[model samples]
Target: MSHYDVAVIGSGPAGTMAAYHLAKKGISVVILEKEMLPRYKTCGGGLVYRGRRRMPFDIESVVEREFKQINLYFTGDDKVLTSLRDVPVISMVMRDKFDKLLVEKAKGQGTEVKEGHKLTGITFGAISTLHTNQGDFQAKFIVAADGALSPTAKLAGWKETRKLIPALEYEVEVNAEDFARLSSEVRFDMDSVPHGYAWSFPKKNHLSLGIASTRRKKIDLKIYYKKYLEKLGIKEIIGEKAHGYQIPITPRTDGFHRNNVFLIGDAAGFADAVTAEGISNSLWSGELVAEAIFESGLNPEKAGRLYQQKLEKDLLPELHTSQTAARWFYGYRIIRNMLLKRYGDFAMSLMTDLYIGDRSYPKNLMKTIKGKIMEIKNPLM
Candidate 1:
């Protein structure tokens, strides 16, 4: 078996980021991926500024559009916010291009990335042995950066907090002028979606339109999305190409590490429950775990424990708070309206913070609640 100091399973943003961090620190690491670089990944392609901040290299090469305006719509409630920020708050990207770009960057940093190697099994008794279709490899430490349906987590006997949110997305080409209009702004149409919402994010010359819901049992996502498109007066789809994927709403919040193995990103249940936005969280958590490992002086077991504790203290409380808030806002139109009206841009800024797993919300909660209460007291003042 080939030996290494670290083995990372998967090559998505989380895995690639972890490899980049470790390799930058001069650690021997290898990344195993089932598909080739820049493969198609079904995503909404919305990356907040926080996610962009975590990248080690410049990502301007892949950013299709910079978003300055965020429009939130509600059906039963009259809450709407059209705040334009001076700084670009969001960016649109194509995951196929974005994921591949990062992997190349990691390789440039001396990371060994092996594509077309599917992880079949893993034995974690003494030194960890990763069984893959390519061959068997052993490592002193393993980082499970594989996504939601992670084979690494399963093989390592990690229990995950589970809730699946299915999303259906369509990438349709549009006229350059129309695309330009979309690129300058992003819309979240809540009226068109009851339990979930419909989003329109512009990417270069294409419009990434999607609709999602998180009902317990699986329903027909296509039907819901088609109705959504029709409601928007999109009579004919310009591009036939489209994709879909699952979002784990209930993430592994309790803990993510076991012994010498650690899980990151969606595999570790680090996704935001309210928006299902996970890119920033994945990058942050990946970097956090890498720092913990380095500071541990390469002691895998101690690093794993410290990483778990810090993750819980630093991230889980906000996730729990957001999840609770999501359930409240989805049902109570009044609360949603009150929040948008009172908090306005400040509230949205806080949302950006929470999306990236910022734990400072406890200090901001009283202000949010006070502003919301004022809005509720007077509809228009």
Candidate 2:
């Protein structure tokens, strides 16, 4: 069996990010991908500024579009909430290109990716053996950065405890007339789906349109998507490709690290609770785990503790606060609309602030709501 310090399953953002950093630290790391490189991945492709700022290298080469302002629309509300910034708040990317570029960066740092290596099972020990269709390999640790349907997490002894919601996206090419009318800005229309929202993101040549909901089942995403197209006033379509996927809004309850295996990104359910965005946190978690392992000097127990501590200090708390906010925002629409009517732009802007990383979700959401009702000065901060 080929030996390495760490074996990372799946070459998505989380895995590639970890491999990149670990290799930079002179650690022997190999990424195992079940598929070939530059494969198509289902994603909305919107990278918020908070995530963008953390990139160690400039990503302009792979970026399709960048917007300094974003718009939020409600079903009946005529007034659109707009948040503008001097710097681009969101950058669009096609995952095929983005993932490939990240893989190249990791390769530059001495990371090796063995494509078409589908992991079949794992035999755990001081040195674990990864059983893949291609061959078996031993590693001191394993990083499961594979997406939501991760077999690696299961093989590593994790029970399925992540709250996965549904999402559907279509890479649509509309008539030139319609594209011209719709391609200038990034917008999300709330109330377009029950307990969720629909978004129209402008890419280099087409629109990445999709819908997602916190409600797990009994939701017809296509029906809502059809209605959304009518709402957008599209005259004709030139081409279209639909991709349906899941977004994990809740982290797995059972710890992220076990038996010398570490989980990051969707495998650990690090997507945003309120917005269902995950790229940023996936990158964040991968970086943190790399640091944990490096700092622990390859001690599995020490690495696990350090990783847990890193998550608890920031990522876990933010996710918890986002979950509470999502409940109010998506689960209870009446209260949200009422507050929107009163606070108007201020309320939406506050959430956008959370999106742009200017301010974090308040530790005490109930107190914040009460302060708003009491009309306390600066209640809408």
- Against the hidden reference, what TM-scores do the models get? 0.90, 0.97
Error of 1 at 205 (Å): 1.5
Candidate 1 error regions (>4 Å): 76-79, 175-181, 338-346, 352-360, 363-381
Question: Relative to the unseen true structure, what is the Cα RMSD of model 2?
Answer: 2.0
> What would the per-residue lDDT of candidate 1 be over residues 65-103, giving only the tens digit for each residue?
887667776655566656565556678889999999989
lDDT of 2 by residue, 192-282 (tens): 9999999999999999999998998878899999999999998698999999999999999999999999999999999999889999999
Q: List the residue pairs that clash in candidate 1.
A: 252-269
Clashing pairs in 2: none
lDDT of 2: 0.92
